[model samples]
Target chain A: MRYELYYWPTIQGRGEYVRLALEEAEADYIDVARCRNGESKMMAMMNSRRLDTPPFAPPFLKTNKQIIAQVANILFYLGARHNLAPKPEAARLWVHQLQLTIADFVVEIHDTHHPLGSGLYYEDQKPAAKRRSEEFWDSRVPKFIGYFEGLIGHNKGHYVTGRRLTYVDLSLLQIVEGLRYAFPKRMKRFERKAPAIITLHDRVAARPNIRAYLESDRRIPFNEDGIFRHYSALDE
Target chain B: MRYELYYWPTIQGRGEYVRLALEEAEADYIDVARCRNGESKMMAMMNSRRLDTPPFAPPFLKTNKQIIAQVANILFYLGARHNLAPKPEAARLWVHQLQLTIADFVVEIHDTHHPLGSGLYYEDQKPAAKRRSEEFWDSRVPKFIGYFEGLIGHNKGHYVTGRRLTYVDLSLLQIVEGLRYAFPKRMKRFERKAPAIITLHDRVAARPNIRAYLESDRRIPFNEDGIFRHYSALDE
Candidate 1:
């Protein structure tokens, strides 16, 4: 069965987390909003009064009768369905818990460029953004990366959940990629402290499906429009 | 089984979400950080290198061998065991999806006062905080509350998932209370547009166990610190 994924057509944003998992599982899915006139369909679904649980925003997945939103929630559903999550109940919760932490980090990354709100332009919040990015690079990035590094070290296996390439690993790969793009110099310096996470990123990147997706047109380029924006002044 | 919850001693913060669920279920649990020498215990656990799955921060629940963190993860675990979540898997996921959205909103609430980063003081970021909070009060708050209002309208039952008092409902109660305390005048005016959410909050607050918790010392008072903060300048 083909799944329907609804999100903004251009940027990967939060939708990338779900896309990476689907690609890894080799699942049949259509990125609905990217198709011609597909965004209108997505909007109709979002604005539909008849639907019982309307999504607050895009990046919702339509499978059978259910429409699941939130990046972590979608990944959690896909993980269980595709065996991308752990088998044990406690382990499954742990995977979801890791994804939630990643979600929080993503928000902070987004706020580095848009500290005020998403509705405002990056130019409007550049002053606050500058201060925010400084703190992010100096403190937040290392804290988060160090936490993940600690996790990898604790696990007996290569991945977050010991030998399993769970959805959390896929999301972690995205985090590393996004950080490298947004703060290359900072990440270069920070990499030495987080060798485990860095190794995990390299490992995930080498996976055949992930490698193909990274090189293919399916992967969206990082831009100022997306969450991990590369503002030279802010990066410094 | 007695669950030990590790969180900040003073503020309700993110821990409050978990606290509400435990209180509602009338589960045997201790707010670990609030007990004598509890903050030291919490810090030690956070910095512990022994555990395979060490939590990144507090608001983690220790039940026997399992250490669960993240508000939604903790709630999901408790909900399943105590029958606070919906019976069906799909409904359970829907409740989780809603809670994640609320979690996003909470991040925004926290950022309103500390626009630069959590490392900085609210007073230090007052200028940016003023601008950020104005946008939150005017736009973000309405957008989130309005989305929930639409959900209540779309659903057949009174609660988020209908008929059952899920963990999402308890969190919603905390949201309303926190928002009311933080932005009294604005919430008073905003309440007219979100009658359904207001009603839901009232209903959750009136629950036997929840009512008792709110009236007792178990419920911490809202203060200058925490996710929702009241600043006269920011409010105006």
Candidate 2:
């Protein structure tokens, strides 16, 4: 079945996680918000009071009479259907757990530039952002990314969950790429401690389907409007 | 099967969500961290390198040789086994989607008190916390909580998913209670706009199992250390 993905057209944001899975699986899908009049359609569906299972936010996948929302939840659905996750229930839950941890990390990474509140401009919260960013790199980043590094070392495999590439690995690729773009100088130093994560990131990036998708125009460039933004002040 | 839940000893943090589900299901489980010598065991399990699937953090359930982390993931597992979720794949996904939304709301609420970073104490980030709390009460709270309110109104049932009480309903109860504890002044006014959510909260609270759990020592009191902390400064 062809899937319809609803998200902001301008930036990868959380939608990129879903996009990576669909691309990796070679699934037929449409990036709805990128299509002409698609944003309006997405808003209409979101605002539609008639929808029984209305999504709380975007990055929802619509297919077969169901609208699934939340990045991890969407990935969970796609992973089960597309052979991106393991067959065993226990192993599948483990991968989803890692994805949820990635979700938490994403929030922390975004807060580095918008600590005071998302409603406020980064310019308005620059001082607070700097302070938060300092804490993020000093404590949060290592705590989170290091956990994955340890997992990779322990698993002794190219992927997070053994040799198979699950959606978690796809997300880790996005995390590495996003961090590098958002905090080039800091990520340069951080990369030294997480060679395994970097290696996995490179592997996922070089995957034929993922490589094609990354180079395609459908892949939205990372921008300040997205979760991972390049701001020199916050980076340093 | 007896489930062993690993989480922090203090505070009704994320662990409480899992605790609620177990209570509602009347499932046999041990709050590992709360038991004697349990905290050390929890930390050992977390820091163990030999374990193939180590949890990034606590509030994980170990049962039938599977360790499930992430509150939504654990609830998804328990919901299926305990009849707390629907039978259909689409319906079950809808319930899980709502639980994931609740997870996001929890992060926002936690950040209202610790916006700069969780590493820094509330005392250190008081001004930033005030600014973040203002935006949270003004924009975030309404957007997240109101979505659930709207869903309840649209569902026109006793629960968020209609007719049957799902884990989402239990989480909504926790959100209402936590918000009331954390931001009494703001929530007093906010609750007026979310009467349906408040109603669902009360209904869930009045359930025999949940009420018993809330009254028992198993339910940790909301405190300064947990996700929902009452600081008069942040509340206003």
Candidate 3:
């Protein structure tokens, strides 16, 4: 079945996680918001009274059966269907748990640049942002990345779970890429301590489908409007 | 089989969501961190190298076979086994979706008083907290609460997912109670607009098991350290 993905057209944001999963699975899908009049269509679906399971926000995948939102939830569904996740229930839950941790990390990363409030402009919270960014780069990044590094080391696998590439690996790739783009100097230093994550990121990037997708126009460029932004002040 | 829950000993925080579900189901469990020397046990298990699937943080459930972390993930597992969720896959996914949304809302609610960084004390970020709290009460709360309100309106059921009381209902109860404790004045006015949520909160609180749980000492009192803190300045 062809899937319809609803998200902001301009930036990867959380939607990129879902996009990576879909692309890796070679699933037929449409990036709804990126198409002409697609943003309005996406909003209409969200605002529609007819939907029983209305999504709270975008990056929802509309399948033939139902609409799935939340990047982890969508990935959970796609993982089961596309063999991106393990067959065992316990293993799937574990992968999903890791994905959820990544979700938490994403929030922290996003807040580094908008600590005061997402509603406020980064310019309005520059000082606060700098402070938050400092804390983020110092403690939060290592804590999260170190946890993953340990997991990878213990798993004795090419990927997070095992030799197989789950959606969690896809998300890790996004995290590393986003971090590098948003904070190149800091990420360069940080990368030395997270060799497994870097290896996984490179591995995922080398996958033919993912490689093609990354080069494709469908992959929205990272920008200030997205979760991961390149602000020199915030980065340093 | 008895479940072993691992979380911080002092605060309700994310663990409360899991506790509510276990209570509602009348499931046999141990709050591992709350018992004698339990906190150290919890930490040791988390830092253990023997475990293949290590949780990134607390509020994890150690069942007979495997451990499940992430509040939403644990709830998803327990919800299925205990009938706290629907039988159908699509319906179950919808409930899980709502739970993930609640998880997101929880982060925002927690950040209202700790916007800069979780590591930094609220006193250190008081001004930023005030600014963030303003944005939270003004837009974030309304947007989140209003989404649930509309869902309740359309569902025309006693609970979030129709006639049956699901884990989402339990979480909504926690949200309302936390909001009332954290921002009494703001919630007092805000409650007028979210009649359904308030009603659902009361209904869940009145449930025999949940009522018992809330009244028990096992239910930790909301404090300054928890996610929902009643800081007078942050509240107003």
Candidate 4:
């Protein structure tokens, strides 16, 4: 069955994560929020109580009678769509653990601006953003990257899922690239010390599906409107 | 085998979600965080490199060598461990979607205080917290509760695992009760309107193991340090 991905039309935002997975899995899916009058359709879908479950926000997904949301949760759902996650009980949980890390990283990226409140405008909270950015890079960013690098060191594979590429690996590639775009100098300091993670990021970027998606108009550029905003104040 | 849960010594915080599931399931587990000289062990457990994957933060679960983190991810893992989620592909994905919605709601709860950044003191950021709390109750709180209430309405039983009591039901129960404690005024306005959700909360709390857990000092009281903190300024 084809999947219907509901998200904001212009900015990649969280929807981009779902989009990458669908494209990689070679699934037939429609970007429901991107087509003609799609945003209105998303509003209508949000109001509909047709399923046993519903998502609280966009970047939600649908197939058959089921609907799901949250980027990492979406990826875990889609991992079964492809053979991306390992099958044993222990292995599957690892995939999930990695995805959750990505989610934490994503929240930190968003908080770079809206440190005061997601509802408030970025311009209204630039000073607080500066301080939040400082705290994030000093404490959070290194710890997260170091953890992933250590995981790669322990796992003995290029991808988070060992011999195969998994949803977590793809998202990690996105996160590292996003950070590089958003924090060039800080990343330069990080990349060498964490070679395994950098290698993983580079390998995922070179994949055919990801490369195609990145080059095509399907991928949106990073903007102040989305999660990975390039606020110079956030970077060291 | 026993499951060991590692989180801060106090504050139901995120650990409460895991604690609720273990209690409701009557599983063998230890809250390893509260013992004498516990911080070092908690720190070491958190920093352990044995994970096939690494967690970015706490509220992680470990059994043998496997570890899982992120509140929603932990529940999803435990759902499988204790058969708390539906086994069918469609049902499992849908449950995960619901958990993600809860994650968003949790973020809203935390933002009521950290509106200006987690690094700053609540006293230092009370002004921004006021605006954030107002926006939360006015926009997000209703929007999220409305979504979950609609989801419960779509299903038949008190729980989302059809007739079975899934971890999502227990967690939602926590959200409902926590909100009542934290946002009595706003919740009073909305709670009666969502009967199924309210019933679900009561059902989970009424479970024998969970009821016992709540009555014991082991189930920490709601405090400013946790997600569902109450401050007069944050209320209408």
What's the true lDDT of residue A86 in model 2? 91
Q: What C-alpha lDDT, on a 0 to 100 scale, does residue B60 get in candidate 1?
A: 99
* TM-score of each model, paired residue for residue: 0.98, 0.99, 0.99, 0.91
Scoring each candidate complex against the real one, what DockQ results?
0.88, 0.91, 0.91, 0.61
**lDDT tens digits, residue span A82-191, model 1:** 98997688888889999999999999999999988877888898888999998988899888888888888888678988887999999999999998898887778878
lDDT by residue (tens digit), candidate 1, B1-92: 89999999899999999999999988999999999999999999888899888898879999997999999889888999998997688888
**Clashing residue pairs for model 4:** none
Candidate 4 residue lDDT tens string, B146-235 = 776776667676675568888888888889878988888888888778787888888888888888999999889998889888886676
**Which regions in candidate 4 have their CA more than 4 angstroms from the true location?**
A184-193, A233-236, B50-54, B81-83, B160-163, B189-196
- Residue-level lDDT of model 2, residues B1-236, one tens digit each, is 79999999998999988899999999999988889999999999998889998998888999988889999999999999998999898888899889988898899888988888888888999999999999998899889988988988888899988999999899889888998998899899888898899889989999999999999988889999999999998766
Q: Can you give the lDDT of residue A95 in candidate 2?
A: 90
TM-score of chain A of 3: 0.98
Ranking according to TM-score, highest score first: 3, 2, 1, 4
TM-score result, candidate 4: 0.91
**CA lDDT, every prediction?**
0.90, 0.92, 0.93, 0.80
Segments of candidate 3 deviating more than 4 angstroms:
none
Winner on lDDT (1 vs 3): 3
